[model samples]
Target chain A: MLMNDKVPLIREKALWMRRTAFTMVHRAQLGHPGGDFSAMDILATLYFGVLNFDAKRPDWPDRDRFVMSKGHATGALYSALCAAGYFPEDWLQTYMQPKSLLNGHPNRNYLPGVETNTGPLGHGFPVATGIAIAGQLTGATYRTFVLTGDGEQQEGSNWEAAMVAGHRKLSHLTLIIDRNRLQQGAGTEETSGLDPLDDKYRAFGFDVVEVDGHDHAALLAVLGAAPASKPRCVIANTTKGKGVSFMENVASWHHGVPNAAQYDQAMKELV
Target chain B: MATVTPTAAGLQDCRNAWVATLEQLAEADPRIVAVVNDSVGSSKLNSFQKKFADRLINVGIAEQVMVGVGAGLANGGRIPFVSAASCFITGRALEQVKADLAYANFNVKLVGQSSGVAYGELGATHHSIEDFAWLRPLTNLTVIVPADAWETAEAVKWAAQHDGPVYLRLSRMPVPDLDIPNRTFRPGKAEVVREGSDIAIIACGTTVHLAADAAEVLQAEGIHARVLNFSTINPLDEAALHRAAATGAIVTVEEASIRGGLGGAVAEFTSANQPVPVERVGFPGFLPTGSTDWLFQEYGLSPEGIAAAAHRALKRKA
Candidate 1:
């Protein structure tokens, strides 16, 4: 129950999540491994130790909601969901197949844990804000969480939702920006400098917190705190491919699958 | 083609009917809520907002957020009616509509006000002439363009209980109410206003009244043209369309572009099922500076223009 005592369990869950995600992507032959790796630890912490959810009753009205805004990292979220007993772990082997429920992105219609259908960038944040607003309206005691890619911050709609969230002072909402530095092609700084990300969020009435994305203890500590009266934003600083030795901080690995030799080496490194 | 004079002036803005019906539904069901993009005045939701201020969510000019929030509210077991200008709501937030409401199948009603050149003097930027074409292609979205105030009220009531995504296109333009005798609004059913065998005159939205007037002109010319009011553009009443095609000629009119609207829909349906001589009456392209009436007349959406198109279709039939 205590945050400190849960670190080792969460770390083990995070490793399993990374391994499952990598294996799914490798078998499916199409995925964003770098972003998935960067976001896995956060997903593990939330599903395992931070959030209140019932996998058996995914539609429980009082259950907390999570939206994976960086939808390309579906592998990581799927891994976490499987670990949390949302679905059969055997289903992960059929990901991205012809008729699999595990689509390239999250689809709420097909999967129960997916709160909303989100693949297009900058969409999940506003939807999460709306969910938070609903919680406020009905006096429901449930929190809403959303994760977005660093490159996805360039969309103007995110700011639009941010303005509404700030104006409404939706304290039940939490937004996590996967600040892994590398986008698909180049670094985010080289493309669209987001150096003052914290100031921008703060100006928009968010309680901004920066944490090491790979550190389960730090993530649990920051993400567990409640907002005073405004929405919360967690800037998770991370390496693109955190666990793999060759792929860490590499831009090409954003969506690239590893070869057989490289895959074996990466699996060894993960262990 | 002889021109017939326009009808007398007993008209009501459809937005009033929409707001009245919405308030009634919200009163009965606590789950119904209204979401707007700073469009309370334009959408005529002031009275409803006053009645249930807590349920009225004003997202302040952000169309994307407005729609996204509607989906979220629906996820929370609240039925949200999202109201905004047609041009901005459908054009700016089309992806959100496609993904959040349609694909996700959320119980959200999208009310597009001032549709189909209703904001006539505001120029092409304000024209929602492309809404039908844009929304019809997306799956799982029921597209309804109510012809008058009674139909608008009925459509809003129906959308409230439908339990799926709906796009209700309401107009600011005032037009005489066509007598829809058994006026229940169904998703894809066409109302036959008149019966004949010479030809069929199909119309919808702001142009249905014009089609009725055109039928009178054709009748005077000894051509008894049937008149059909097609309120639902998608999931089109193919049975009614095929029956109309049996008359050997059809004239379709609308307040939107000649392509991909009521005219295009009819043409596509008829060509695939029953090929008949078809002539489409609508705006060929963007309009110049003019009132809605002037634009309607200039772009062959008037009763006289519709009559002329009927003659052209008859000639092609011959």
Candidate 2:
């Protein structure tokens, strides 16, 4: 769990992420708010209390890596990076605008903290597995973390990467699944069932950890833990569109835009 | 049978040179690593695996992960050479190659072994004829098709030293080394094997030597044919192409499909910049069951066939 003094700070960061992300989505009118809200707290916890990174020295060889595998949730990732001081807060205003560095997906070249370009599902896990293998090969002390939507677990490429991470025994790797249960059109269960997700990962030789995704203290508790003998997989159970009451658990908000009234409601509820 | 007779050096597979150069590079730099998709034997990396056991990552028939791992290894400061069969490496994990390596601009080298019709009898699925077309659009990638073992070794050395993404398309088909006096590996530059005024015969990979032999055939017929070993496909040596275009007639040869290999690159360049009668010698599409020799002879990849194509282009020019 997070220290008593840091828990409040992390909680405050998470609230800011929700508000900022919602604002970006409202302005853009073309953002994945449902997925973004579900993943924001996890991003907040990692940037504020868990991950080891220097925005100034972003290319530091020994820096820990956090790959945002669920890339469409740029609202969450951009806000967290901005808060971490990777760039000025004003850059967040251009989120998804033409020629903005904050693309629909995260690009490592354009942005400082993005580990790799990931818009297509199932890409992040394999790239992150590769990063972990690099650490293992050189005996490097840096850790690699990747976050994928539970819905994205259906992509065959993820399983392919899981096997590599397992076969190589990449102990320094951690995979966090934002288990919000909803995909773009429908529930993950209705679309493609991933209920035995934890068991599948365990079968792939990852130590499984299930956590309440929105709870900053619980998130810190599991995310900040040391590496186990096997690679780690954290299934972060969360509600889709968690912060806004009207959008909560609604599938249409997967890429839904908010009108003026709804925007005001979301902004008020985000706090 | 290959058009060229056995030289004093004898027949040598390019994979041998690839592994040898990789071994040397690894010895010099600890950051050099090899990632494969259960292709250690096919890629001729058995010795590499033995020497750098911990560094050789075998992702067990997983091309997507193998490429992604290469990009990841580069991120960790290791220059990774990801090797596999040309067909699988380019087809199976194409998106991974595009996003992780090319689009992301990772410092990785992708070695495509047994390119073209090396697996001739194995049928169309095993042939990597479409690799050029598939990969050509990704401008970030450097596509190098080495002609012989000497060029193969040089290309590997160059890839290791260069700090960007590259695709080294190596053929398993044995080829005699080009008889150039002072050879230097200038990527994106065509090698002039023979000088002539009547026509220019452009070839890459296993067909370069055949183009030279075709030049000899044309020479005996009072048609002095210029032979260019056009190795790099992506960055079309436009300077050399301009010179070739000045000759008024050209014959482009390759072991790949005519749609997008060297033939396609030449056709695209000449049609727009310098309109000339260009004869493209390559496979039209899928091939019937045949050995590499029979396919080469049937598809005009042989010296006589290339010479005939050069004649046809000269006729069109007149």
Candidate 3:
């Protein structure tokens, strides 16, 4: 659990998370691999390094809450759940199967650690704010972390939540924007520019931090710091498809499942 | 028993009842939280917010985020009632309502204030005529429209005790009391305000009293019109609707749009199970400007309008 020991372990776990995500999407025949792969490192780092949660008790009142606001990245979340021991690692294979609980979107009914169901954009941030407010009301020490896609930030609701978080001064809440720059249709800049994103959050009363999203050491260091009297937002500048060569920076891979050859190439890249 | 006078004398806005009930609940249970979308005064929650400052969450004019935050509060074990204007809460943030509250099956209560045409002069942008239609199709959501202050209090209590998601539409328009002094609310069960066999008038929310007045007019015409005040729309009292349809003629009324409100619910229910002649009374579409009372009269929502619809449904003339 020491910082020196945790950093390398989280990186390996991130790699495993990507591999499992790729395998799950391949089996499901339908999933978002681009954002999942892009966000895997942050997910791994959260579950392994920063979150004060035990997978055994997903509903622990005082446990830190994690919301996948960018819910299309369920592959990354499910993979992190496996690594965090919420479910068996083998459960990843059943993802998006006819009746598999591992749906394209994170479902709280079937999955542990999923605070809310999200698929349509800009849904999670407000809920994350709620979690933070609940903690404040109950006097619980647990913090809330919400991971949203940079493109998903375009949905207005996220800014609304940012305003609320600042107005309420939810010091225990942290928002991590997966600034992979790419969305399903195109690059976030081409679709709808979210640049000056960090400034936007800062103006909304957050203690903003810009970090390398894929670097576990830097993420852990930044996230480990105590939140000030206001909510903290970490704009993690990231690259889509972090591990795979062909899929990296490719917007078409946003939801396209890897074929056998591509899957193999992804698996090789992870190894 | 107060004999259920169903009178609007000393009528009170149900939004006030919401604030009173919410304040009472917050006092009793610290976990009871109210979340509003910068509608503190609009939702009549300023008193509650002042009393329980920490418990009131004003997300500042964002309906989509307001609902999502309510869901998150539920996730964190605080029972949150998200309060917002009905038009924006249901129309603007509908997907969040579907995914966060219903699909996720959270224990959040959605309080939609100023429903129907309460904001009449504000036009369709502020009138939530389509809420019933938008929410009717979602599973795991218990939709309730309180007819008066007492019903609003009862519904709030019921929603707090209930274990799942619920949508409670509280009106700014004043309504007469529907319940006895100590009457309580029962979700999914329609309250039969008056009984007759000639024809049945099914109504909910602010329009229930209009239906009663229509029944009185029908009685004057020697037509014993049955009156059913339905507060719960989603759980649609199938048995009651069937019996109403069995009466051979049915007139349904609501403060919402005719397309998906109580009338539509009844039609959808009776069409599949027991098809019958039905007259749905509500806003058809394309709203016009006026005061609430004026709009209600213009849209044929007055007692005379209900009676006319009843006559249309029951009369045997070609």
* Candidate 3 overall lDDT versus native: 0.87
Q: Determine which window of 10 residues in candidate 1 chain B has minimal summed lDDT.
A: B1-10
| Candidate 2 Cα misplacement greater than 4 A, ranges | B1-9
| Candidate 3 Cα outliers beyond 4 Å, as residue runs | B1-9, B179-184, B316-318
Model 2 clash pairs are none
| By DockQ: ranked, best first | 3, 2, 1
Q: Mind sharing the TM-score for model 2?
A: 0.97
**lDDT per residue as tens, model 2, A1-271:** 4255578888898889889988898888889999999998899888988888999999999999998889999989999999999998899889889999988898999999888989889999999999999999889999999999999999999999999999888999999999999999999999889989989999999999999998888998899898889999999999999989988899999999899999999887867
Q: Which regions of candidate 1 fall more than 4 Å away from where they truly are? A: B1-9
Query: What digit string (tens of lDDT, one per residue) describes model 3 on residues B1-318?
Result: 001113366877677778888888889987799888788888788888778888888877788888988998898888999888888899888999999999999999998988888887778788889999999999999999988888888899999989999999888888877643445567898888899988889999999988888888889989898899899999888888878877888998988889977888888887899877789899998688777888888878988999998888766322
Model 2 per-residue lDDT tens digits across residues B140-244:
899999999999999999999998899999988888878999999999899999999899999999999999999998899999988999999987789999999
TM-score of each: 0.97, 0.97, 0.95
How well does candidate 1 reproduce the true complex, by DockQ? 0.82
* Maximum-lDDT candidate: 2
Q: What is the DockQ of candidate 3?
A: 0.86
